[model samples]
Target: MRAVAALARRSVRAGSGRFLVEGPQGVRELVRYAAPSVVDLYVTAAAAQRYAALVESASAAGVFVHSVSDEVLAAMADAETPQGMLAVAQQPEPTLADVLAASPRLLVFLQEVRDPGNLGTVIRAADASGADAVLVTDSSVDVFSPKVVRSTAGSLFHLPVVTGLDAEATLAEVASHGIRTLATEGEAALTLPHVDLAGRHCWVLGTEAQGLPDHLAAACAERVSIPIYGKAESLNLAMAATICLYASAAAQHGTQ
Candidate 1:
């Protein structure tokens, strides 16, 4: 139980090549999408009953499903209030070559993004917007962290996320795939609507506080800014990323 709870720590997850998936939503998706990676599933009796279909799916995948007491579930979960279900799953290994090989039309490149919630929200938005993949630099937060995985709300398992990349080299490689790279900046002369998003492109986003550094912005083919109409100081990083991704989605689908 102590070892299971220790999975919440990044060092433990890294060393073990495993991470915890909490709640019904995350566990359900993990079973449905990445079932082969599931190692052990722990659930309370009530959760097993409530999420019977889910448990059945996990069992069918040959996952070890353990029904433990509520106290045990609490000890194994990372959430303040245990969601009654949790799972230990192996981490996925995706590469940049894999992403490029898919001929991705639209993509997102996150540079040094530090906030776990913001990173998770951006990943969820990318999935919702039909992004081919999410390329994350090593400077960013661990996408497999409990906060990030939970915040993704199961979108984490929906799409491919290639991590541990060098920011500049990644941008160049994606560009080599014939995808235009657009940096999201507050002061860019080009606004969102003016940019041609109907074609293959990648949106490069920055950190929560500092945003993209000048050199990273220069590396991209273009820079864009999301206009603020109201008195608000600025848009949140996740909200900005959502707007950017959805814009490309709309353009690609001819809905814009």
Candidate 2:
């Protein structure tokens, strides 16, 4: 219990090279896609019974399973209402070089995005939209944080998520591959529909509060905006990213 609780902290997860995946959805996905990295799984008796197949899968993959009381499961979990299932898995470390080598046509670059839910949703959206990978600047929230992991619903293990990147260096590196960087802003002259989304490109998103920095926006190949048709003053970062990513997906696939 003490060791599992310790993994909740960023420092501990960093030192241990491991992070927690909470809830049955996240755990099921983790077990299904990343079974090799799963070290241990904790489940309540009820959860074990309800998700017997998942537990069996984990066991077959050689992951140690611990059946504990609900109280005990809560003690080791980050959420108040433990879902009766959690898994500890090694963090994947992928480099920009590795992502580039895959020749991804669509990408999302998060700049100093501090909200875990927002970051995770963007990753999920990226994966759903068939984006090749997701990149995060060093200033962004820890990608492996509990909330982020849960928000991903297992998409975290589906794609290459290169984290701790230098903003300018990554921009330059992707540019070398003929990937156009499009900085999303509310005030940009070019709107989403106007931008050319058919080619290899990357959508650069900023923090929730500040959006993208002016300097970074200027550095991008194009500064684009998503049109607001309703009374809402602006779109949530995650919502905007989903729209942009899907727009790019539709365009690139010629389904529009």
Candidate 3:
């Protein structure tokens, strides 16, 4: 129980270099990715009865399973309704250089993004779009926050995410890699679909209320906007990011 509580705290996660993954789907993803990395697995007796197959699979894979009290499991879970199972897995250290070395060179830089849900959704979209990685600036919320991790729906395990980058330093590093940086703005003359997104690039999306910082926007090789004819003042950051990523994916595949 102390171990479970420790895993829930960010400072402990950083010190231990591990994070918790809850729910059957999340645990399944961890198993599929690699079972040996899982430090500990916990499930209530009720959950074990409900998800016998999953429990069986975990046992077959050599994961340490603990059938704890339902109250204990509930206390460990971030969700209002606990899913009954959770695992502590090592968090891989990913860097900008490492991501650039990977395939698809296309990356997403999130600046000062406060909402974990939005960040997680953007990470999922980035992964689905075949992006090399997602970079979260230091001003942004912690990627390992429970809300963000749960919102990721386990996509976090499939993609490389680098956090704690200063805005200017991040831009400079990405630019040094010869990757074109595109900042999205509602007022930019160019629309996302109209831009050539096939080249190695990094798309920068800012906070919801305030858009990109002026210096950062100016650093971008191009400023692009999404076309909207409705009464909505602006698109949600996650929605804007998804549209831009897909547009880039389509352009890269020559389907645009």
Q: For every model shown, what is its TM-score relative to the native structure?
A: 0.98, 0.96, 0.93
The global C-alpha lDDT for each of the candidates, from Candidate 1 onward, is 0.93, 0.92, 0.85
Q: On residues 120-174, what C-alpha lDDT tens digit does candidate 2 reach at each position?
A: 9999999999999999998889999998998897899899999999998999999
Supply the global lDDT for candidate 1.
Answer: 0.93
Report the error of model 1 at residue 190, Å. 0.3
Pairs in clash, predicted candidate 2: none
Candidate 2 regions exceeding 4 Å error are none
Report the lDDT tens digits of candidate 3 across residue range 21-137: 888888887777768888889999888999899888888999999989888888887777658888878886788778876644688999889988899899999989988889998
Provide the RMSD of all predictions against the true structure, rounded to 1 decimal: 1.0, 1.2, 1.8
Query: Which candidate comes out best when scored by lDDT?
Result: 1
Q: Candidate 3: misplaced stretches above 4 Å? A: 254-256
Model 1 CA lDDT for position 95: 95
Give lDDT tens digits, candidate 1, residues 65-168. 99999999998888976579999999998899999998999999999889999999999999999999999999889999999999999998999999899999
Go through the candidates in order and give the clash count of each. Answer: 0, 0, 0
Most TM-score-accurate candidate: 1
